[model samples]
Target: MNDARDVTILGEPERSDRPARPGREGKGEIHLVHMYPREMSIYGDLGNTRCLAARIRRHGYAPVVHQHHPGDELPEQVHLLVGGGGQDSGQVTVEEDLARVGDRLRSLADDGVAMLMICGMYQLLGQTFTTVGGRQLPGLGLFDVTTLGGEERMIGPIVLSTDFGDVVGYENHSGATTRGAGQAPFGTVRHGRGNDGSDGTEGAITGHAIGSYLHGPILPANPAVADALIGWAAEASTGREFEPEPLDDEVARQARTRQIARLLG
Candidate 1:
């Protein structure tokens, strides 16, 4: 119920003293908004925001992170949006508040603002989510998909063949989502369950908005996908192409490789 703005420059605790890296002097700020952080950040999903903020800084841009809660106004300018998963009770808690700002979120997506919605947030961005008890929750309809809660919870490591490359993460959900004909999947599932246990599709994507169930916080090991989101946001904010400096991702690469191998083998 506390709607105060919690702003932070992720990674730089002492903003006044740290000297800017060479070539990073002129780059401005990229506003990253985290929606319902208090209610929807279960399963370490807050890591996604931290990952983006750190990477944004490493890419020579300052990440201005805004944590949005119920009754709070969204920042006037949002370069990127990140929302995480939560329990059914948590979903119910934010259901009304989510609807209140659904229009703004949909508008942002239509205008190509980059967004990443994970698990419960992903489900709520679709047309509808029917819980196991037959209760229905209305979504923002950003993704042309529908979800039905099932008895079986899909939980495990997952690998997806995506446009960005191989994306690895963990999926834990009971919602079985089915995409409409107009919806394009974020990736093809290569291992474990995705939106549904049977669909072979991992997630849904339209324009710059993406909805996925993969959570191992989903960004640390899949830097490619994270960078893609950052790139889209940067371009949309600046109205120009974004060329980020290459950061060493060897550790992430190795981590991804090991996860994939462990899952596939």
Candidate 2:
């Protein structure tokens, strides 16, 4: 943790001195860890963290954000993990750190922790990511997918239709991801080159984790996706049926509409 960029969060103190159980804190607080923000949060991806925190707070539960870096141990009580894209150098660094804690990440996912990994982080969640030079970067294998670098990078605004709603964002990646059998995509590509130029898929969803190349920060433009993630986290933390009070997302809705219209037109 860089002291300059990351602060020791002074959230509400614990009510008791005893160690709290994982995923549950004082007064039903949700712990969100922004993994390697300093290293991986390129292309406005940090906005997703802020958006999630705001939505979680609106749900009447305390939200504690940890700006966790590579090499930091995974928090035992994490309810969600958000990571962003990076360049090749940054991907190598992140890969090393993820390799160290990959087991813990997979374990947390199995325990119902929600995860949102974008671009480079998304690629690293798969089995392997082959670079343009034919160098293969080993991944965490959290999802049944593989990525191979393409000659041309795909960069533009995009609109995708999902079960939740129509999500609009921008995608910038050269890697073509192919899903293995049984792997499900987050949505079908509606206006952009998605996981691969040929496939109509835009992202991958396994359990509670979402891997996508979309990066208009994603959550700001798609409140439904943000709420869905928080819902999953809250349920996992409380082990109860949780229904969050809906927030007025008129601005986001309008923004998404404009984005889709402009991009599609």
Candidate 3:
């Protein structure tokens, strides 16, 4: 795993795509657009998209992820867009590029487009996040939250409850978040809520859009999460229902168990 990109290869990205009409091949393809440079591959972020593609294929669907570099053309069709964590410095390095996609991103999320962003990516999707500079910088304003100053970051095993069930992932972010009034918290903190007793930060989300601090390449550890995303897209984009099947093969099961255990530990 390179520091610039960590991919745990649970599966590969598929070539085919969903039908535009009910069962038409290549009729509709769920696209995942990844912004930022290689996400700095912090703690298995690439695994999220890899797991997404794999889970979609396992459920009889195809996914194409467009890894967008600055000046790269955006895909014409996007069913779900994902952004993951990176260092604060890394994100700041590409702030202008990120802002360039602001209108497109806001439109997608506002139109009920399915999305999942974690940590650094989550911070980018907000209205503003405070930095150590004691000044607030403008964010994409996709969500009603602000990142606050914090010297400590939450890392290691994290537990949270979702409609799916008790979910698990890791946290590693110094930018604490605060949701606006009437804003929905993405995921709740089951363990450590803040670096100290002061400004306790938490998760936030709106509609099909989800932004969380959970790391550990979130999707691989929680297949339900990946499937939830795929199912949402399939239902929304193609009207075909998707159901995520748990790994049944001994080999696959063992591998999954080992990985999830590692994350949990």
Best by TM-score: 1
Q: All candidates' TM-scores?
A: 0.92, 0.88, 0.79
For model 1, residues 185-206, the per-residue Cα lDDT tens digits are: 9999999888888979988999
lDDT (Cα atoms) of all candidates against the true structure: 0.87, 0.82, 0.66
Clashing pairs in 3: 18-28, 19-27, 19-28, 20-27, 20-28, 186-203, 186-204, 186-205
User: Could you give candidate 2's per-residue lDDT for residues 90-157 as a string of tens digits?
Assistant: 88777788889988888887876899999999999999999888889999888889999878899998
For model 2 the TM-score comes to: 0.88
TM-score of 3: 0.79
What's the best-to-worst order under TM-score?
1, 2, 3
Off by over 4 Å in 2: 1-27
lDDT of 2: 0.82
Clashing pairs in 1: none
Misplaced by over 4 Å in model 3 are 1-28, 37-40, 194-201, 243-265
lDDT accuracy of residue 81 in candidate 2 = 93
In model 3, what lDDT does residue 36 have? 55
| CA error at residue 52 for candidate 1, angstroms | 0.5
Clashes of each: 0, 0, 8
In terms of lDDT, model 1 sits at 0.87
